[model samples]
Target: MAKASYLAGVALALAAGSALAADLPSRKAPPPAFVPPPPAFSWTGLYGGVNIGYGFGASSSIRGGELLTQVPGAGPFAGAVDVAAGAWNMPTNLNGVLGGGQIGYNYQFSPWLVVGVEADIQAADLRTSQAAGVSYISPVTGAGVTGYANANQYVDWFGTVRGRLGLTLPSWPNLMIFGTGGFAYGSVESAHRYTRFDGSAPLFATQASATTTSTNTGWTAGGGVEWTPMAFPAWSLKVEYLYTDLGSINQVGTGFYSAGAFGGPATMLVTGNQANFRWHTVRAGVNWHFNPFGSSAPVLAKY
Candidate 1:
């Protein structure tokens, strides 16, 4: 009985020791939890691109003066003439192509938002010309008369300064939609012609010319979409549309020439004219982006 009891005690002790060995702290450590790095900032650099688009615009009608006189060969000279009618309905509501470049600086405000300032200029030959056939009647000469005149004007140059706001999407690569608003400046010019007749007798044939020009400041707004396909290469493209409200301006012009025999020499006439116009443009361009603060590897990660 004593031997059996001693053997049972020894067995219990060995079992407890074996259980402790199994419970000892594990040797293999828990797998390290995945730690993602912080997100990066984009759109910090100088970018320039070419834009090609269409423009639609219009001009206002110009009023003129009338004169009646009786000269040597010309009898009963009766004629109402536009002493001054510079280009009447110049290039307005006309469509044409435009190409230009822009320069800007972008600041990263947040992971998903960016703000920028930009200035650009465009040179185009977009113009429209509308003319009305004019005639004159000499009450003194009791005869009918005829003449010709043309009002051809144009708005060809423009510049803009704007503030741009952009939104960055979470989708792979860099893609955004942006809006812009700011100020714009531009000018308009026109050419004119005049003639006289002594009761359709074509008494004094004279040509007069005039031009009107003015500078205006107005507001502009637009929006566009941008895409960056390759992250490392930092290449981008965008499409946009803009509306400019240039207010209005009066175009005053003048011309000098001979018309009636009574007038020893050519006479000078000044015209008071004005116009109101609105501009619409659609454009697309490419951009190059650089990440100044990025990973040692490719600054941008491509999917």
Candidate 2:
């Protein structure tokens, strides 16, 4: 009877222990692998991206172009007459859209300062066309003269190599504002078409046209604000404004005329067309960073 009581007590203890084990939690599949948060946001990295923007030319900023007239049919003139050259103002609205890609690197040297270098190339259709009557008193004889001028200017493509200096906002860790300036260059084209009429008769005239294209080098300066979203740590967004010089393109036309100043077909008349271009651009862009928040170097490539 004592042995039976011992066996019953042992069975009761084993049942209680099993119930306690059932109440306790299991291992939970190793706590779901302990995922860590993303690293801190940093601008120290290499990035490449694309952008689209509008470009506007300041007609007033363009100077040094020749706006002049051809020789008029002065009765009883003995020699081939020359005309004076003056500055021409492009008509309002030398503006169009532009788009391109950029590559750059940034290094956050201090808590508030970030410096970097960037290169970009763009294709554009920012153009200006004007046809007007230009009048000026002859410098040689003080005679009033009126002539026609026609011009076309274009900023076909442009690029820049610039240095950037940024200021980080303490309140917004992901936002930064920066100033940039450096070498600017582009392809500029201009064409001038002119018809010079002799005397008061509009039906009688000579026509000459010339076109010029050149790659001009100048300077650019601008500022912008950039932001890196927490949700996209490897991508950044920016809105920027820049003012760049469009360089100079000129056309000088010298064609033999059949009749001018009683000089037959071999008579020579010169027509000059000149202009310089400068403009402002506003752009919005996004960049993809490589090796973000890594070592001091922004890019993974070798130096």
Overall lDDT per candidate, in order of appearance: 0.62, 0.73
What does the lDDT read for residue 40 in candidate 1? 55
Clashes of each: 11, 3
Instruction: Please give the range of 10 consecutive residues that has the lowest summed lDDT in model 1.
Output: 75-84
Instruction: Give candidate 2 misplaced runs (Cα > 4 Å).
Output: 1-38, 60-76, 87-93, 135-146, 200-203, 260-272, 296-303
Question: Which pairs of residues have clashing backbones in candidate 2?
Answer: 45-298, 46-298, 65-274
Q: Which consecutive 10 residues in model 2 have the weakest lDDT in total?
A: 61-70
Q: Which candidate's lDDT is highest?
A: 2
- Quote the positional error of residue 171 for candidate 2 in Å: 3.4
Residue 103 Cα positional deviation in candidate 1, in Å, after optimal superposition: 1.8
Q: By TM-score, who's the top model here? A: 2
